[model samples]
Target: MPVQVSPERFDEIVGEALDLIPEELAARMENVAVLTADAPSPTQRRGRTGRSLLGLYEGVNLTRRSPVRYSAVMPDRITIFRLSHCRIVRDEDELRRRVARTVAHEIAHHFGISDDRLRELGAY
Candidate 1:
């Protein structure tokens, strides 16, 4: 079973995880929003079975964008699911580790890393 944490503490953990990202990557992160949600919405869970998502990246990947037409688009979004992550960990320390991993995994998606590649690199 997972451990419980106050919402404020969870947000702090998320912030800390984000801060752990490499400086070069963080500096290059443009028009991207990092958000936290209680859980994945129904639409996000469609076609999945008994699996919970810890984080999700939604938008055009950097590698797939057209240089001429990408400027006017909305910022990409990366949502970290708080309750889902909380429900998958054993303690605060584990929760922190999980948050860091989830954040990195989603950010990789932003960099055009596919799920299969993430799995190959053991980041998934």
Candidate 2:
């Protein structure tokens, strides 16, 4: 039976998913931030209307090189939407799985994985 899960439960699940990331993959992740938001931006509109986006990874890809090193690293953000996830997930278990998948999708982008490759790996 599917039990109703709260926001706190989803947060905890996302946390656990973060913990499960392989050390090598997790190590390459630097200054990467994960957050939960209610929705996407005006620029993100592609005809779909929703209160939240399942996840978002906003950061500079490795292909873009910086000539100078700064004192502080730039912020790399990954936003996960709770309500969006809940819409597709029937229970806590599925939600956690989806969260883990979303994390991998964004993290892969950060790690320089191409969109085609990501799709092949089932990250999309």
Candidate 3:
């Protein structure tokens, strides 16, 4: 039988991954909202290839040398797609691993790590 997964279980897995982030790095992140969606929203699907991005990190690049915005709102963040991820993986363990990897990938973006660098680091 195919392995079944629940969003609650996925949320628990994400929590575990969040706990794994380095403390110093985690400190730099604020307002990390761990949202789980079945698929990319229309807005998320806009302006890109029709294929959906598994996770997204919306924040300022750390490498940029500009004054920080005073909007008081830290950059919004880290949304994971549950259904999309599960469809590509075979079992629960694989699903958990993918969740952890995707979490790291988005966190890398928070630290201004480029996608290429993230791939090189095996976070993708």
Best candidate, TM-score-wise? 1
The true-structure Cα RMSD of candidate 2 reads: 3.4
For candidate 2, the 10 contiguous residues with the lowest summed lDDT are: 62-71
Model 3 misplaced stretches (Cα beyond 4 Å): 1-3, 50-52, 63-68, 120-122
Question: Between the candidate structures 1 and 3, which one is better when assessed by lDDT?
Answer: 1
lDDT of 3: 0.75
Clashes of each: 0, 0, 0
Error of 2 at 76 (Å): 0.9
> Cα lDDT for residue 54, model 2?
71
Instruction: Return the top candidate by lDDT.
Output: 1
- Model 1 lDDT tens row, 25-70: 9997777899888888988777767678888898988888887969
What are the lDDT figures for the candidates, one per model? Answer: 0.89, 0.72, 0.75
Task: TM-score winner between 1 and 2, please give it.
Answer: 1
| Candidate 3 local Cα displacement, residue 35, angstroms | 1.8
Worst 10 residues of 3 by lDDT: 62-71
- lDDT comparing candidate 2 with the true structure: 0.72
Backbone clash total, candidate 1 = 0
lDDT of 3 by residue, 1-124 (tens): 3346788887887888889888998888755566777778888777868555778776564554255552455556678888778777889888888888899888777667898987797755
Clashing pairs in 1: none
